[model samples]
Target: MLRAPGVYRPRADTRLLVEAIREAALPRGAHVLDVGTGTGVLAVAAARSGAAEVTAVDVSRRAVLTAYLNTRMRRLPVRVERGDVQDPSETRQFDVILSNPPYVPSEQPRPPERGGARSWDAGSDGRAVLDPLCVRSARLLAPRGTLLIVHSALCGVERTLTRLRRSGLKASVVARRAERFGPVLRARAGLLEARGIIEPGQRHEQLVVIRGDRPEPLEGPEACGDGT
Candidate 1:
């Protein structure tokens, strides 16, 4: 139950991510961070999954408030903070990081600074937020930490995997689901088709959850290697 007008509502993508989280086999008392948390759905789910410390961050103030309120109402110990994943200020690392960020491609070169559009509109190629998040994941995760991010396949799932891997994390697609176009995507169907981002008459998009894991540190000689 979100009271904020601009906060994104939990939909198919959210449900998919939650299901993946439940199947992640998170260790008890694991620390989790939810980026772009709207209404704290994923954060609450993390708590229910036995995460000892759950923190949620979002760029929108209203979204932060809504998430905090929802978590409180559910009696979940989730700390909701207002922050942007693209330019995060928090320095704490976590065992798991979760996100269902804006992935919709828009005509504008960049997302809106305010209003409802901020919740779903990504840049022209839909990599505005996704790219940055992938780059930062390695730094945000603790040893053997995992990152689970959900987005439309139209936004380039392969690109995400490549980026995360280049950042020194093992990445792969763990889950996927095809969903019919919603009001937002439906309205941009023609433009997306024109841009060759979608089929001429495509009415659905595949949502994928990419999982990236930071490898555990090597011990003994590997840890104290000479310059090689």
Candidate 2:
């Protein structure tokens, strides 16, 4: 139940993440990592779907607290931490990794509700946080692991793929919502325009879920009796 403009809502992208993870068919009791788990929705989903362990992390203290309470209320075995993805000391890898990161491009005014830009804005080009996130993900994921991210299509899916490749990961788009949403990719567009990178009215796109895999192929999880 992440309220306001940028925080992730459980019913929104969590369903996409859960369905994808369930389809992966990992062995029972496998470890799953949920990054930027605002309300622990995806973390809880991973637990419900039979993940042996679910570790969630968020940069915001409030978000961490909320997720902690939610997980406690549900009695789910999830470890919630208040930390930034950029920290080098962050360890604890996993078989599966899912993230609904702050993909909104920077330069956009912070929403009045104040979930705080830390939960959203990706910096002047929107790639600030995304780049580091992907880089760290490459090192953090276990061999033959999978990483899923839901972001704006306007952020240059092709560029994201290129970055993933550079990070030694193969990227793919699992789902996309075709509609107008400036809050998603406006920063990339703005930055490009400022640099004469692209012209205005370039037909921005909508939201999309991106899945990147390491060089080692992921072994689909074994089906649990009640994954449906």
Which candidate's TM-score is highest?
Answer: 1
Error of 2 at 40 (Å): 0.9
| CA lDDT, every model vs. true structure | 0.88, 0.69
Q: Estimate each model's TM-score.
A: 0.93, 0.77
Q: Alpha-carbon error at 70 in model 1, in Å?
A: 0.5
TM-score of 1: 0.93
Lowest lDDT sum, 10 consecutive residues, model 2, at: 219-228
Q: Kindly report which residue stretches of model 1 are placed more than 4 angstroms away from their true locations once superposed.
A: 218-228
Q: Which candidate wins on lDDT?
A: 1
Per residue, candidate 1 scores C-alpha lDDT tens digits across 119-175 of 889999998888888877677788889999999999999999887877767889999
